[model samples]
Target chain A: MSPLLLILIFIVSTVVGYMIIKNVPSLLHTPLMSGMNALSGITVLGALTATAFALGTGSKILGYIAIVLAMINVAGGFTVTSKMLKMFKHKEVDNK
Target chain B: MSDILFYLLCGLLSVLVLVGISMMSKVEKAVKGNFLSTIAMAGAILLTLVYYDIISVTSLWIFMAIGLILGVIWGFKIKMIEMPQVVALLNGFGGIASALAATVIMIEPEQQNQDQLMFILVTASLALVVGVVTFTGSMIAAGKLQKVISQKPVIWKNHQWITGISLVLSILSIVMVAIDTKFLPISIIIGWVMGGFFGVAFTIRVGGADMPITISLLNSLSGVAGSIAGMASNNPLTVAIGGIVGASGLLLTQIMCRSMNRHLLDILLGKTTSTGHSKGVAVEASTVVTASDSEEDIVSDLASIIKSAKRVIIVPGYGMALAQAQHLVSQLSDSLEQNGALLDFAIHPVAGRMPGHMNVLLAEANISYEKLREMDDINPEFPNCDLAIVIGANDVINPAANTAEGTPIYGMPVLDVDKAKHIVICNFDLKPGYAGVDNPLYKMRNVTMKLGDAKDTVKELIDMLR
Candidate 1:
């Protein structure tokens, strides 16, 4: 990937993401934040690549730790967000 | 995978993530939206393994499994009230992950052309600095939220000077590493140490009330860090998803800042939540109400007020969460409805420790989402309300926001609780809230202050109706 192309992707994604997230009501802001928090852990891709291409034991260990931490962020963030969203039930739903 | 095919897949996955986020705007579809995002993430991870030819890496799978187990356990176990700190801690993990990945990139020998190597080195160093700062800053924020550290703003002597110097040094180190590969080892150390100091200095002076903004900002930084790390590694998928997270966090930060009428720069410079501290003391002395009636008389008066009310609005704040009084609040709302009163909850955007946190707490207590109204939607209804019940809330309902010029909360939007015909307050004490601005609403004749732990006071109110 060229640097110019990568920068373009970042800009396009950010603008589109902002427009989409703007529609989320304040009622769901907490879940939105946590869900976004999970997406930030997409850095796990970088970690995996770095670990795979690592030349030294030290670099490999660091990559492993990064992978683990990013996975925790992704898994935990999504799970907690789902839990919170589940609690937002309507009166009719509660009655049922 | 060929480069063309890989880029196409990245684009497809990014769209899926965006569709998932758009679905979050509606309550009904939000759960499925989260699941979709989870699937997209899993797909992205699997794609990385195959594209990079690392599918057979045993150590990677073991580490990821360990993380998955821990994450699931913690996610299921955390109470709603602890969401702020837990989110902060998770943000730290994401930050450190990016930092570590950047570090590995910096350490591994590069086979790229000279220009490409320079770009990669500079971006990697930048990512490491941002990632480490986000990690340390989030840990401090989590500590403050959990009360492991003091919630009061910690202002060291010449705090701004320290923060400035550390930030400058960190940037300089990044530049040096980019200019010369020989400075890599020393530059990495300087980046980590200076970045850590800068993070702590930046966060230590942010008082508890400013946490919503701080957490949002740190969340944004973590995403930016991940995006930059992706740039360093030339991973388009990481860059795209990380950018989306960054944008989402920035939007939330903007909303939180607007709701509080605070400037992001003022918060970054640690100028908030401290201006009214001395002024608060003077206001408190003159405004203390001396109850002329006995305790029973007060209770009876409140009970009578509740009995006659036909429409009610409940305002809940962080103190309500602290008192674990949501259940009692839910009960009170139920009892009020039984008396034929139309009831709704007014949620300030900055209420509780994080954005929309009060709603989650209320939801946990079995209050239906339909009854929760945002400040703008509910403010107009207050004037028509027969009574306003404020539970462990102060600044959000403080009438001073409208009249008290030069105060920290001046011009900040607040729930118009005073517009209601009658008001009842259940708070811990008469002390000023986190922003240190004394509430003028407590002095109004139409308002009755029930000073005690919100749990006990709300339970008592429930008992009175029975």
Candidate 2:
């Protein structure tokens, strides 16, 4: 597929995935987010695969760029997920 | 092309925002459960072409069908205590998917050329390690939560050695990635297993009182996994948002543990496995006065109390949720207003299982948000108020947190309900709560203990005022 087409596919799918996950109600949120979050790790795999292909195919610059981006993405997910978990820790200090 | 997608997406997303806002008024947590959120997500994605495409549609539909069947079966068969395990297991599935993504990329590095082998190696390794930890550790946590396995700490004198090894291995995995070495996979896998083992041992060994914290830690782990996955995928938004959540979660966990006088190592080492913390010496039962004699008597008594009180603070608890008594609670509040009692609801941060659990329940009852008071705002007034009505709350109002020496819940701030001239508590029974310790409030000379369902108890009180 052409780069344009690949970009469109990526954009569309990301948007779709975002929309689906966003709509989950509070009741289902904990589980849904927990589950979907794990699945989101696939982005790393995608980045890895894309990076290797790019570098091996002589697109060295693009490969390095993708790797850098992918690392940030992975780190961010862990950050946010951990933050959300903080909400559940030992019991909120209600400061009552 | 971009404009059309953008407009369509924006328009669709508005609906989700509106729906979320609509749900804000509900007091019952059940209103905001995952089921509704997932549905809204589906609607948003489909309309905006996020996951409405053919492949996504097919996959989603398959999951939906399977989910529907399982939900139906589980709802009818599972007990309340069993629900946590079920949720935990589901969480594991997500963890596994993330790990699998890492494996797939590792086995086939299509992005190696562009990102350099280093980036792919690093991102893939991080994803694999976190994903595996989330999956296996969550399963172990689910087992303990469900009581399918013992909730005791797995102690060996050399527990420190194991933890040290795991920490070293995890750090080494990161270093391996930094160096762009092929050993990245092997090191990360070992780290993954060790981390997961710690997570499991940590969860299983902690006693029941820390269920609230256990739930939070697991939640944070899942977010970290997402962030790691996002890195491998080169996604900025995921990294930004996910990192915020993960870091904050770890920070919150530390704060909570510290507030409870616990060290992070002890909590993670599963030192709390001994139920000894809550094994309070039984106070010989004291019989003072029954807060409620009969339904008719309570009604008569409630009318008088309503007539006498000026400002009343209401404290809600898990019993309120179990009774699904938001509506009745609202009705009672209204009746109190008519009787000239100024009423406000006090919300403790951890009043219910999840954050804002009580708030959600009160919102459902159509209790105005303005009437709700968080712990900080409402605590000061407790001593001065004519009456403090506690509905199904246990620990949040426990005086032990403030007074008892070496007590498990000591030093945590609690509502000084005992300071009130009159205090009334309603619950189904006198059974010890999740803390598994007898409440001293029930023995207080001034506080009146009313045992019954919150719904029925509140109704009787309302009728008394009328």
Candidate 3:
């Protein structure tokens, strides 16, 4: 994708996000924030590529650290969200 | 042909990911919605990486596998109560990753066409600044929230001027990069340093009471940085996700600001000052200071009152989290229900360190969301209630937010527990909450302070009730 097209998509998604998040009840805001925090960990994709294609030892080391950090964000974030969401069960249904 | 199919799949999954997050709140099966959306998002991200050939190298698999294992292990090892800290740290990691990715792009003198050079520099600079800021700021925030550092707002003279100058310099450095100046590498490093300073400078000055908003803002910043990074890398799907994360984070930040009755500017600029309680005296006429009350007397009194109350409301705070007492509270609530007293929970929006922190805790303890009423929904019902049991909560129940003016937390919306006919407070000490203001609600004639560990106090009450 071209940078221009990517920018357009970014703008559209920002608007879409604004509209969708407007209605989130305060009760769920914390989890929603965390869930999104996890989603933003998508930067792991960048880290993976950057590390793989790193030109030198310095960039390679930095890229490796970035990959580890981003991966932590992604894996930990999703697990935590799901765990928290799992606890949000209705009264009648005893999932635990 | 496969490329076309892959692009279509990415587009569809991107939409599903956004739709999945939005529907999480309304759906009956929120977990299922969250699950599907999370998976779709992961799928889309992975596919995009593969399609771009970013993850094609067989050697990269080892690093990827190791990183995933470490992350999953850390994630599962953490307790649910530490969700805020985990989220904060994760955001920090995202920020740092974006910064490092941008760093790699900036340092390498690779394929850059003249037409796109300016755009790339702009995006790279943005990713660097925002990412660095979020990284350092979130680390401080997570540490403070976890109480590894003092949660008090750290203020020093001449701080505001320092932050302003640093931010301006950072922006100037970014402009230098965009202008294709001689000091491009030097300018990039300056941007990162200044951005890091801004993050710490901004966060360290905010009091613990304002952490939720601060954390949310930083989280949003990480998203914005990721988006910028995506734009720089020419990844459309990543840009979209970044956009979604950033926008939603800002919206939540706005809501948090409103709940505190403070403007976003006030929070960001450190305009709000903590109204420290100089002396532990009751300022409100309605509040009559009671010499520190004994625990046994209050618990027994609470037992008798619970026996007679027709409706009871349990208001929880971070103290409940502190004492690790949600399960005990749930058990007590069940016993209360068994004893013919109707019970409901009133949760302040910013009750815990994180958003919805109390809700998750309560739900974990098997309390139904139906029984947990939001402040707006439950405040009016307090007047008719027999008793309001506040566990380790100070600021949220402080009537000063409602009736008092000129106090730092004056305009903040607090639980109307004072409206109840009787109130029982379970806390360890007479110490003020994160806001550092003595709670005027404590001195109310109807309020009883049961000073003890929340879990022990509540457990004893349960035994007595049984």
**Winning model by DockQ:** 1
lDDT of 2 by residue, B1-466 (tens): 3555644553454344334323422323323432343344344334423321233434333433443354344434533323345445544544555555555555545433454556656765776667666677777777766667775555666766776677667666767767756665576566567656655545555654455455556555655665565556544333333343344335434544653456666677666623545543343323434433565665455557666898898888867876877778888888877778888888775665443445545654556656777677878888778888889888778887778766666676677787787888877776665544567888775566667778888887777676
Q: For residues B1-466, what per-residue lDDT tens digits would candidate 1 score against the true structure?
A: 8878888888899889999999999999999999999999999999888888889989889988988888888889989999999889988999999999999988974733356888788888999999999999999999999999998889999998999999999999899986889999998899999998899999998988889999999999999999999999889999999999899889989999998889999888888765656553635534445644576787788899898899999999888999999998999999999988899999999998888899899998999998999999999999899999999888888888899888888898999998999998898888887667878788788888888999998988888788
Worst 10 residues of 2 chain B by lDDT: B21-30
Q: After superposing candidate 1, which stretches have Cα over 4 Å from the reference?
A: B111-115, B277-288
Pick the lDDT winner. Answer: 1
Q: Which candidate model has the greater TM-score, 1 or 3?
A: 1
| Worst-scoring 10-residue span by lDDT in model 1 chain A | A87-96
Q: lDDT tens string, model 2, A1-96?
A: 122332343344334434433333333233333333323322333333333334233333333333333333223322332233223211112211
Q: Rank order by lDDT, top first?
A: 1, 3, 2
Residue clash pairs of candidate 1: none
The C-alpha lDDT values of all candidates are 0.89, 0.54, 0.80
- Per model, state how many residue pairs clash: 0, 88, 1
For model 3, residues B267-315, the per-residue Cα lDDT tens digits are 7777654554445443442233345456566667767887888899999
TM-score of chain B of 3: 0.91
True lDDT of residue B279, candidate 2: 49
Best TM-score goes to which candidate?
1
TM-score of 1: 0.97
Instruction: Give the candidates in order of TM-score, highest first.
Output: 1, 3, 2
